[model samples]
Target: MKRWIPWLAAAAVVVLVGGGAWRAMAARQQQQKALAQAASQRAEAPMQLAASELVGVVRRSLVLGVPVSGSLRATESAMVKARVAGELQGLTVREGDSVRAGQVLARIDATESQARLRQAQQQADAARAQVDINQRTVTNNQALVNQGFISATALVTSQASLESAQSTYRAALAAADVAKKSLEDTVLRSPITGQVSQRLAQPGERMPIDGRVLEVVDLSRLELEALLSPADSLAVRVGQRAQLQIEGSAEPVVATVARINPSAQAGSRTVPVYLAIAQNRGAPALRQGLFVQGLLDTGRADVLTVPLDAVRTDKPAPYIQAVRDGKVAYLPVKTGARAVVDGQTLVAVEGAPEGTVVVSGRMGQLREGTAVTTAATPSAPVAAASAPATRPAP
Candidate 1:
């Protein structure tokens, strides 16, 4: 009986070991199957994206233009200068003060000018008295010659003396007029209606002829002068519109090409173009010398286009990611003019047909032939539905 017990125990141990080994093998097989199933589901699953991530290539009017940037300037600006040399006085207007045309802006000391005018007037009076004496002498000589008290040649000589004195008197009067003009110039006046931008000369300062006093600018008419290459200038025409972004301004201002310089700028060979601001209620207030940059719309064209960022250059050739047959397809494209339209910059493309769906570069790079679907589609379901939550008991 003891020997039989040993054999039974050994058989029992063997059975227990075999059962455990079989259970482990079954569990391993189930885990492997689950993993394979999950991989298959993942391979079939499509990448889900938001509707906004997708953009359609469309044929639309793309604004064609060249970049232009320059400083703003008032169309009507004047540099007030002193016409005569004297002491500056009564200069109350400072920078930003409003002025009217012909308004008295300042005055120069008139003491010297007044004295000169008096001197000229006194000289003219003395010359007039001499002219009167000459006329009387000529008359007396003529009377003597008629009475045979003097020869006719003596009357002719008296007439010549009278003419000479008259010429001197006329010369003195001309000098007096010049002195009067000089006195009037002492009072400086604003030549145009505008706001003072600079006050160069202060009261009690000595000003010379042609010395700068104030700089006034009319803000009503503002323009930007941009230098463009000769090739770009050839495309720009008067009345063509552009949108400009001014430094320190939040809103963009619309401007029109006002004029084009006939001759190129020296040394640079760049043509200068003037752009006049188109005033509107919503536009921010602008000032002179503000830096502005924008695109000058030279023309427009209807072409297939996409967001400029979508044109990827990572490859040797420029290409865009497009969804065709539910898979990502990279299509090489020839890029043309780029412009801002509807506030988004678009580049003209030639490879993609109109109405083809394309992905934005914001989505990052996507692999070719990868299945893609929008969140609105029903292709993707929860993985738990297909994945085994628990393995069968082994």
Candidate 2:
């Protein structure tokens, strides 16, 4: 039994040594995995940059356009006035109230005119009675003359009286008709269906002929009147499309050019153009009398463009990025006319070719030979092959 114990003790030592070696191998494998993970983290550090944000560009028509500024106004407007002289008994309208055509807005006192009309009618009736009496007398006198009972001169005198009475009745009838019209003219009625822009007269005030009492404007058909130079006006044609931007609105209202004045303005050297607004069909951002600026889309061409946010202006020179060989470089850009594409304003670069990488938003942190990771950035080179061509020194 003592000899077997020695052998068992040796076997136990061997098992312990083997276990220690296995643990060492396991620890080495773990350390290797940890090192690989650390390297991956280092490589991913550049991607942590919040400066690399993506931006979009706006797409628009290639036709050249002339920009103009203008104000909105109603199509129909009038200064409603009083046509007859009388005291205003009732005024039914106020400023900013809507009214229909031929609606009564005020009433004038017509009591005196009514009485005059009655008097004229009474006079006409009396005249008719006198004519009848004259006719009877003329008939009787003629009969008496024929019978030799009345003189010839008496018959002639009776006929003259009858004619005079008839003329008086005709005159009285005309007078009564005139008085009826004068009374009707006292009611001040609206000549159009529109809103009241101003009210000048009140109840109980006497107005003279042709005195203005209210100002009205029609809002259904509104116009955008833009003043542009004669040369610029030539670029715009009737039926062209127009977009209007109201203050504080992100989206704009669309309209169409309706008319253009052929002649230039006297003092401003400008010509007037009108746009008809489609308010009911358009978005709800538009309203009457809204001051706006406009863009006239004149249609598309293939042009070199970059993301609006990608273009950087903070550098020593305004520029964008050119990526190659896993690194990015700055290229100075000369910009030209701006156009909107896909709701983005793209500044046209003179010589920048297509496929150039523009450092989009927050590009201030990037510099020459900066290592960049475009694996996540859209439309960017996944793996660059070589550096970009350098601008030749002067």
lDDT of 1 at 253: 89
Top candidate, metric TM-score: 1
Candidate 1 residue runs with Cα over 4 Å from true position: 1-54, 280-283, 315-317, 322-330, 341-343, 355-359, 366-394
| Model 2 deviation from the true structure expressed as Cα RMSD, one decimal place | 16.3
What TM-score does prediction 1 earn? 0.75
| Candidate RMSDs in order | 12.5, 16.3
Question: Per-residue CA lDDT of candidate 1, range 321-366, in tens?
Answer: 9888889999999887775444566777898897778887789899
lDDT of 2 by residue, 264-350 (tens): 888998888988877765466444577888666543233455554566777676677666556766677775445454454455454
The lowest-lDDT stretch of 10 consecutive residues in candidate 2 is 384-393
Which pairs of residues collide in candidate 1? none
Give the CA lDDT, 0 to 100, for residue 280 in model 1: 87
Model 1 alpha-carbon miss at residue 223, Å: 1.6
Off by over 4 Å in 2: 1-63, 119-175, 285-287, 299-337, 342-344, 347-394
